[model samples]
Target: MNLLKSLLIVVIGILPFVVNAQSNNYKVRKCFGYQRDSCTTSANIFYKLNEDSRSALFVKGQSSQTIVSIYNGRDYRISLCWDHILGNRMGFKILDRETKNVLYDNSTDEFATDFEFTVTQSRDIIVELSIPGESTLSKSEGNEELIIIRKDKEMGCVGVLIEHMITPTKGF
Candidate 1:
């Protein structure tokens, strides 16, 4: 009877840890491939997906970046997709990796989420994504010491879909 009780105690003690671990894993797995699988299907008809396309969990006011090689003789399209909680006008920028010159900024184009351009020269470039909003903390009941946690502050998936194809020859 005592051994059974001890085993019961052990199971109870381990239960919370196992549950917490699974929840965390679920959060991560949930975000994986979110953008590519859900958002980019329409584009697949025209452009082949580049291997660097990816998705990740993002919080408001967070920024993330990735580098990819843009080869000459190809036309490329970059599209951004995110959970509505992350807002509609997320910022996206493409910069020359070595020179740090801004090649493209979505803000200039009315914050358009999709961009298409033909590469004239092969180069490595940086693709930067930014989510807009304040941090998760907020004042509660006009008290600075008290905090109000918001469910909307939860992380959401952001996807950068990169697709490309050979630039078609022009003029017969």
Candidate 2:
């Protein structure tokens, strides 16, 4: 019994370090922040959204702030799951390059759904998501990255740890 207890204690002590390990992604351009042993995802990921910049839109009022910059004719999807129910609020400012007009600006509100967007130009872009300091964010800001760029009194408090940017290699 004594020997068994000693082994168990050692395993428990090393578990935290074993868990809070480095993460990697093939498409992760920049890893700005990180945290471990917090949420179900195990690790939070932040990547630079620079691939497609022309067609940019900020994903406002989301559990995870999803900022995506994609070129013309590319399909992208972002999925964010929280420990608790997330407030459904997201807005988009889709720009029309040729006319240089605000084509579609809609606030996306849903209980929990996979947000999707398509870029229409090969230009630089910006997308942002915001989450309220509610239930889902009960734990510490384990690992988060808030983009320094703020527009028109916009304060960023979105703790979106994981993000994925999808780009189309061929076909213009």
Which candidate leads in TM-score?
1
lDDT, candidate 2, 1-172, per-residue tens: 9999999999999987764332223254222222112212322233333222221112223332233445566544433332222233433344544454654444534423334555566653333334443322233264684444232122222222233344446776
Q: Write the per-residue lDDT of candidate 1 for residues 1-172, one digit (tens) a residue.
A: 9999999999999999986444246456766776666565443476888898888878777788899999999999988888877787899999999999999999999999889999999999999998898555421234557544444455677888888998989999
Give the residue spans of candidate 1 off by over 4 A.
Answer: 1-28, 41-46, 137-152
Q: State the local distance difference test value for candidate 1.
A: 0.81
lDDT of 1 at 77: 90
Top candidate when judged by lDDT against the true structure: 1
Error of 2 at 60 (Å): 15
Candidate 2: misplaced stretches above 4 Å? 1-10, 13-68, 81-107, 111-113, 134-172
Tell me the deviation in Å of residue 92 in model 1: 0.5
Per-model TM-score, in order, reads 0.74, 0.35
